[model samples]
Target: MHRMLSYAKGLLWLALCALFFSFSLLLPASAAVEGGYTIDLTPLLDALMPSLLGGVSLLASMVLAWLLRLLARYTGVVLDEKHRKTLHEIVVSRLQQIVTDSYEGNRSAFRISTKSEVVAELAGYAARKAPGAIRHFKLDQNGLEEFVAGRVGAKTLARLKSSPKHAPARLPPKPAR
Candidate 1:
């Protein structure tokens, strides 16, 4: 394709040059003697005019090509920036929704799932802050069951969970004999 384009450009240049040169040859020589000074200016004008016009046309085409290249570059940058910005917005909004629903859904639901390794690491951070409050800190499904049970009952334990302010500093183990 590139070779074909180059060949086409060379042909166009040759054609333009031929046209400019031939215009002089095509003109019938009309010699006028002005006070013994032979001025064959018509032939010169014919050659110069077509060449000048061709040069001007070529220069204009180059400037238009340069402007088009600049325009394409600028448009591409703007579109890519907008695409990245929109993608970031969509991801952030989805994460916000997940965080909101994780804690605000039905009361019977177990919270702060630690099944995934990443979630377990995050839970460890929270557990370290309030080690005495959290229980059944494991990756097994049974931990989710225990969390549900701890959050559902209506006894002092439930009240302690409800109003963390009145919760005891320490809680007894359920299986203690």
Candidate 2:
């Protein structure tokens, strides 16, 4: 839609320029002499055509350059978004793997490890695995730590809920009528 609007604007500008150029050609090229007026078509056509052509060419070039700039900017924004999304997915998958590995099926070990320790370990792993992504996304240490901590907290809660020890006990059967 934006591209279409740009093309439309360029066409509108060209049409306006063409209209102005044609009108300019129709204007009288006359000089006042003593008790008379002299019209010279040759000199008028020679001078006017070159300047008009130059003006139209300049306008066209400017419009083309503007359109090119817009296109480049749009492409850059699209690429940046794609890169950021890929980086996010990589980080999330790495974080999940680190959490699962640290679990090791031992509740005691999971409980003993501090949130900060887990974050540090995950951060190191992510840096090793996706250094370019971290830099491109501009993810700072604090942000990475917070993200790891949040995911870890959620995972811990989910593990606790799924564990048999935390599951609701079955109620005894109701007394016979």
Candidate 3:
């Protein structure tokens, strides 16, 4: 029904435009009252025809191009930094959760995508409490490079001689209701 109404409106508008144009053609040319000046209204019609067609066509093409641009922007696939960052954070957080949860609440034997962040936090946290026993424990990962190795410092590394080799642990899955 809405589609039919739109089509009817379009046809009605076209018909009205045609009627106006035909009526415009029937009008007599203007006569000049002053010195040797002849006014021809036919030139107005001639000029209006070309200008109206050109303007309308240009406007239509521009509108179509704008709509297509909007559609492309909405539907097009654009993988950028934000997408990568989101994925990286999700994986990092999930891996960290799994690593932290796998053990019986004590420091787990292993970590995933550790790269020294959570380990440094744990080490530093333990250091404040124990100090001597929790020596230099440096977290490590192979493909995931040392993002905070320098920050861990030398003194921490001395007591923490053995950190487990970097490994990919099973990440925790999101819960199902």
TM-score for each prediction? 0.24, 0.39, 0.24
> Residue 134 of model 3: what lDDT?
22
Best by lDDT: 2
- Candidate 2: what lDDT? 0.62
By summed lDDT, the worst window of 10 consecutive residues in model 3 runs over 131-140
Question: lDDT tens string, model 3, 14-55?
Answer: 657866985665543232434456656577678677756765
Pairing residues by index, what is the TM-score of model 2?
0.39
For candidate 1, write residues 1-177 as lDDT tens digits: 476457557757876886766565554333234335454657666767876677668756765776786897877765555544543344334334434444344333234323343234334443444333343233244453343333232342233234323223344568958
Among all windows of 10 consecutive residues in model 1, the one with the lowest summed lDDT is 151-160
Winning candidate number (TM-score): 2
All models: lDDT? Answer: 0.47, 0.62, 0.47
Candidate order by lDDT, highest to lowest?
2, 3, 1
Q: What TM-score does candidate 1 get on C-alpha atoms?
A: 0.24
